[model samples]
Target: MAEILFPALFVLLALGVPVAFAMAISVFVALSFGSSYPSLVVVKEMFTGLDSFPLLAVPFFILAAEIMTGGAVTLAILRLAQSLVGHLKGGLGHANVLSSAMFAGISGSALADAAGPGSMMIKMMEKGGYDRPYAGALTMASAVVGPIIPPSITMIIYAMQDQHVSVGSLFMAGVLPGLLITGLVMAANARVSHLRGYVSGEAMPPLAEILRIAVYAVPALLLILLIVGGIRFGIFTPTEASVIAVFYALVVGMFVYRSLRIRDLPAIILRAALVAGAVLLILGAARAFAWVLIIEGLPQFLAQTIISWDLSPIVFLLAVNLLLLVFGLFMDPLPGVMILVPILAPISLALGIDPNHFAILVIVNLTFGLCTPPVGSLIFVVASTANLRPSALIREMPPFFLALAAALLLITFVPVLSTWLPGVSGF
Candidate 1:
């Protein structure tokens, strides 16, 4: 299985097979050629992967994000972000970063963030005198916060993979780091804006108007507090919180905002269903792929070998960071989490690293991949949404990439950044 599975997986990926299909087919090929086990095991493992109560949050959260987008909650948040930051130097760029952070609270998926609010911000920034590719790159970079913040789909999947970290714990753990990444991206935007002579064209809004916008945006923003607070206080489980989020978003979009209509739900549901289906497919395939590795005892083999190296915790974490960064260059975070968490998480635990800390570090590292070249999904989403070439976006990515790398290092070396909130919150 070891000999046949990895090679087949690589070859298929090199052939441009989708990650989900590639993993599933690799499992089928490995089972048939390298073991007496029937191919039925592959199907069984894939189905088994999707069998969890907590997993229900995946689609519900996705639907909530879709509903919010269709209902104009996203636009409200963007307005609030703009009112707060749009008066600063490089105003539109700051607004882009701020909106991505605010939107990340509602939309757990990075691609959704990039396509929805991110696309809008790109257009706004370009109109405000920023370069098109630069705006797209900033949007792509800032949107990585979607998965690092609370209500994260990646963290949900990650919590499922590693039991030591609960959804609530991970949610609390993510707050500061998410803010850290947001600040770093904003700083990068400031530097670029300075160099390019990007200046604010609009004056700061009057206090009364800022207050009104905040008041209007509060309902949408409360959804974040609702989810995180509900889970932290045990008012609801993360799965239940997700369901409540859908209803809450519906009410806010329809009643308060009057942006959502009954007629609009079908299309929203279809889009959410498609996104959810794709995510689950990758998870299922990754399960089968990881199952093949477990059967081959590769995890144990590698764990034993690494444990024998007598590496310090700091050294081990730095090494894992490097490995994950490289791995992320090729894979999306979801599948990357599914396949690698089972292998690397146990090793981190053995090294006495805190689970929540390790989990956030891995998650943050993989999200960077979403904005990276070769397989950066956010790059493509932003590019297509903004009508810019991917190469153009990539060319503008270095400063933002350096910022993200700096954030990753902070999360890696300073476990306190990831663990403290969870600890204080009683997670």
Candidate 2:
């Protein structure tokens, strides 16, 4: 059953079926082909998978991101990051990183970061003398930060997978790592820019201009602070924070920014709905796939095999990182989370790994896959937007990928990096 199930899914994926439907087909094949179980389980499990209060955050965050993106909040963020960092060596790249980080907190999605600010950043960097592929590389690298920051949909899905972790704790756990990636990428950008002569040598926006940009961006920025602070302080649940984010985005866009008009909302809402619908469908399918594993006892079987190896926690983490990196290259993180967490989380816990630490490691590693080759959707998004080649993007990605490797190692080895903030928050 296992052999028939897993291979059929991959074969279908290779044959161009969507991930969600691939998962659904796999569920049916695994269960119905065997007399041990019935195919009726597929529909039930997929529906049960999405029936959750916490998962409500998914659509709300997508809606909020779409609203903010449509309102030019990303441009405001780019201007602020540019005014602040656009004078340094590789300043445009640095600004790209900074802008993506800011948008990360708002969007909680790598795709949104790539499609929104990321495309604009690539254009800016290209005009500033950066290589186009290099610019796309940096943009792709920075976009991963979106899922690592607060209000992350990936983290929320993870929390739902294991009741031991909460959305708030996971959100808090991501902050330092997000900042850590930001610093590492910026340093790498600066060094490479110096060697490659990619520095823009542009003048900084004046203090007055910077201040004006800051003032204009404050309301947009406040939404992040509200979500982070509210969750950390126990003022609201992460799901509630997502709701607040939507309302706040609407207010800021219509009144403060005056960029999101009332008439503009139908298109924005429709866009958000489509993205959210796709995500939920994938999540539902993943849940059903996971259920198939549970019914077959595959997780216990896999866990026992791992335990039989008597591996240390660090060694297991290293092995997990390698697997996730490969998976990320081909699979989207949503289904990856759904399918793997059930199998892997139990093993990690038995190995005495902190759930928060392991969760962060898994999330960050998979998020970076968005920047990698083959199935990296974000790579295609940026490449399509910038008219750059994936091959050239791959060639230009070494420095940034190395920086990401360093960040991943830091988070993997120093479990404290992922756990400390959650602990400090009293999680």
- Which of the numbered candidates is closest to the native, going by highest TM-score? 1
lDDT (C-alpha, whole model) for all candidates: 0.91, 0.89
Which regions of candidate 2 fall more than 4 Å away from where they truly are? none
For model 2, where is the 10-residue window of minimal lDDT? 30-39
Model 2: residue 292 alpha-carbon error in angstroms: 1.2
Q: Quote each prediction's TM-score.
A: 0.98, 0.97
Backbone clash pairs for candidate 2 read none
Cα deviation at 180, candidate 1, in Å, is 0.2
